[model samples]
Target: MDMTGQRTLQVTQQQAWEALNDPDILKACIPGCQRFEPSGDQKFAVAAGIKMGPVSAMFNGSVQLTDIVAPQSYKLNFDAQGGVAGFGKGESSVEIKPLEKGCELHYTVHSSVGGKIAQLGQRLIDGVAKNMAEDFFKRFEAELEKRYPPAEEPIPQQSAPAQTSAGVPVWMWAAGAAVALAVVVMVTR
Candidate 1:
């Protein structure tokens, strides 16, 4: 099966890259992911419980990152076993681009399944994969927001009350006029 999609994340490219490579963040974001830990350089050991149609199983997998470009893109190769349920092996490429407000993540997956999972029909498998991808992104964005909240708009600085040509504030002129009027009123009385 092949799948491709893109998401606009409300985070900087560097922030997105760091979260993607973090084992803790990935584990929390992945649906039914029970374990995700680094095994070696650019490699991780993973276990997740997945249910598709009437079949459910715990998949043990290892993922290795390759073709890495720091804070930009990488290729992931994964292989997993679920005993009688089936096995899945695949490669995916992920790319991150900086957007005006945040960043865009693009991913492509090409994977194959065997054993009973393969017998479940292509449409079912595709639907499950799509749902999993969407779920992952929703969790991922929530995590990002928690880790790096959007910067406040600086509270606008109050702007100094619109300075005049002489560099005096316009509010100062109004205050002077009020004071002069008060002085005239007191003298006339």
Candidate 2:
């Protein structure tokens, strides 16, 4: 699978790059992260609990950063194993561009999986991966906002709108139901 995405953050490129390298910040941002530790200057070992369909597993992974280009871009090689569930290996590139208000983070990844995960079907796997990525960045961006704040403007509270009352979007509720059904079917199959 190939995936690409970009997000603009309200912080300088330098600050964004620095935060990206911080193990503590990454641990806090990564969803289901059990442990994340730096093994070397640009290498890390991580363990995360992931649930996809019925194939939930604890994944242990290593990531290596190469082709050094400080604060601009770098290549990431990653591999992870999840016992009976499956394994994943991939390569990606992350680029940072300084914007007037903050920074733009662009990433592209080419990845593959095997075992039960691969058997789950491309649409399911892709959707799950995309959701995971979105979740990670949401947390990461929140953390960065807390650490940096805005230079000139104060951050706004994310209170739910009165229309939703509970703040849950109707579409999201439907999506959740759909995913639950899909998971049930996938696991049973």
Candidate 3:
């Protein structure tokens, strides 16, 4: 099946890019993912449990990230087997663009399936894929918020003139000094 979609992430493109490259973040973000470990550069070992139609299966997969452009885009190649439940292999391209308030993630997926999962019909497979995609991004957004929430604006510090140790304002002292200076200047003139 062919699929395409976009998600607006409440984070900078660079942050989203870094999280995507992090295996731990991806593992946590992926629904039903049990394992996602780096095996080599741009390669990861993946294991996830999923139910498609009525068949529940554990999918062990390899994911390869390629054609990467820092903080912008990458291509993902994935191949997985579910034993009697069949198999799936696919490639997906993801792109991120900085928005006024956040980043927009765009993705395109082209994939195929065979065996029992494929036998479940295209509608079911498509629905499952869509759900997985939505779930992954939803979790990813939450993880990003937890890890790098927007910095709160710092409160302005009060100056001595704004408040005094005693209940009297420091500005009163300054005014008194200024009056004294004026008197001295007038007398000197």
Question: Best-fitting candidate, measured by lDDT?
Answer: 1
Error of 1 at 112 (Å): 0.6
Q: What is the TM-score of each candidate against the true structure?
A: 0.81, 0.79, 0.79
The CA lDDT of each predicted structure is 0.86, 0.81, 0.82
For TM-score, candidate 1 versus 3, the one ahead is 1
Among the numbered candidates, top TM-score falls to 1
- Candidate 3 — what's its lDDT? 0.82
Whole-model alpha-carbon lDDT for candidate 1: 0.86
Residue 135 alpha-carbon offset, candidate 3, angstroms: 1.1
Candidate 1 worst ten-residue window by lDDT? 180-189
Using lDDT as the yardstick, the better of models 1 and 3 is 1
lDDT of 1 by residue, 35-101 (tens): 9998999899999899999999999999999999999999989998999999999999999999998
Pairs with steric clashes in candidate 1: none
lDDT of 3 by residue, 63-86 (tens): 888998998988889999999999
Decoy 3 TM-score against native: 0.79
lDDT of 1 at 24: 91
